[model samples]
Target: MEFWKNCWNCGHDTPQERVALEFFPRIVEMFSKKEDGKVNQRVWAVFYDSYSFTKCKKCSAPSLFVDEYWTQTTSPEEAKCIAEEVKINGVSKSGNLVHSHIYPGFLKEPFPQWTHDLEETYMVLFWEVYQAAALGLNSLAMMGIRAIIDKFALDKIGDIGGFAKKLNTLLNAKIINADQHALLEVVVDAGNASAHRGYKPDNNHVKICLQIIEQLIGIEKFGDVINEIRQATPKRT
Candidate 1:
């Protein structure tokens, strides 16, 4: 008997053993086809309660966790719509996904706007990291070391001097190596010159700064972080 086998998501016929369906009608449709013997199939199943966990590329620690799954359906459009709607609803209910980490001082503002800004900063940081990894130091250095620090996690250190001290401490603890340490110093000096002394960083310096960050985090770890951030980032409107 010739069976009409297709992807539960897109209705695209596939030889794969299992088709993942996302909604109730799709699941019912698959079963109906099986029961009527219109299609040759052994099992019609729906994916429910599926959870995905992402691990940090550097430390291999659990970083991001998502615990929700929709019922299977035969429509890819419907599945996509459901996923997007779920994500939008989540953000509306929780403000922003990344905002969950914000504390009282800088992030505690008029709620939604504050959360949106945090999300923007996080996106920029990820872009910077990815550019550094792919294109090397030249690309990242242009943003200036101070800017990177400020954008990434420097405000948490308070003042510029304190930021420099913290970088040194990280280096000393072997959290960052010698090359990264040197790059950090250069970036701080360049940033200070630009911010306090009205001096700007040359293109070469920008490249070097990017390279330093890449070395410190490693490409694989950076990729993992980027993916996690993407997964957690909230959609606007």
Candidate 2:
């Protein structure tokens, strides 16, 4: 069967075609003898456990493969088929896999009102960063991070020369503190290096950028929430 799965190498949610490498099934039979010396036969549940390797068919720059398997069961003839079923789950990658599917910082909820009000363009770029990182495209992911920063600056300060100036303006206006400003400078530089210098950063680099971006977003959109939480939290004696 053909299905879609996220490629760990290419960082793309590509189509995969499964070729059944091995399949093993277990079946049980029960028999009983009647008082009249006649035999009755019945079949219980038929269990199936299968393993297969699928190669992503959607990418051209060498295919990424995943090993997947399923464990399921079908009731006997009378009970009907497909008593329980679960599709293949990705277990391991084919190569030097350093990335995992879990990115806790990935934004799933709607943007906080202030962020949306600031610039809705950032919302789309934020998602693109998540998507690019998910598919293992760190370069593209960094670019998305850069785009988000640019969008935010443009919305807040309008056209002010380049990204560096816009960031300076935000800093001067105290929209972001010194620490936040420094961290964003790293993100902007990393993204710029990727775009202009053809630098493909590692996963850890991209991860730090994603986290900083999340923090910036939280601060920009939900500053009130942060303030309320701080006030509600009790200090140690």
Poorly placed runs, candidate 2 (over 4 Å): 1-19, 22-120, 223-237
lDDT of each: 0.44, 0.64
* lDDT of candidate 2 over 1-237, digit per residue (tens): 666665544476777676543434555455787777688666454434334455668653233342222223353421122212223333322212222232223333333454445445676777667778866799999999888888777777897887778788899998888888888988999999999988999999998998887777656766677899999999989
TM-score of each: 0.32, 0.50
176-198 per-residue lDDT for model 1 (tens digits): 67876776777767667665665
How does candidate 1 score on lDDT?
0.44
**C-alpha positional error of residue 16 in candidate 1 after TM-score superposition, expressed in Å:** 51
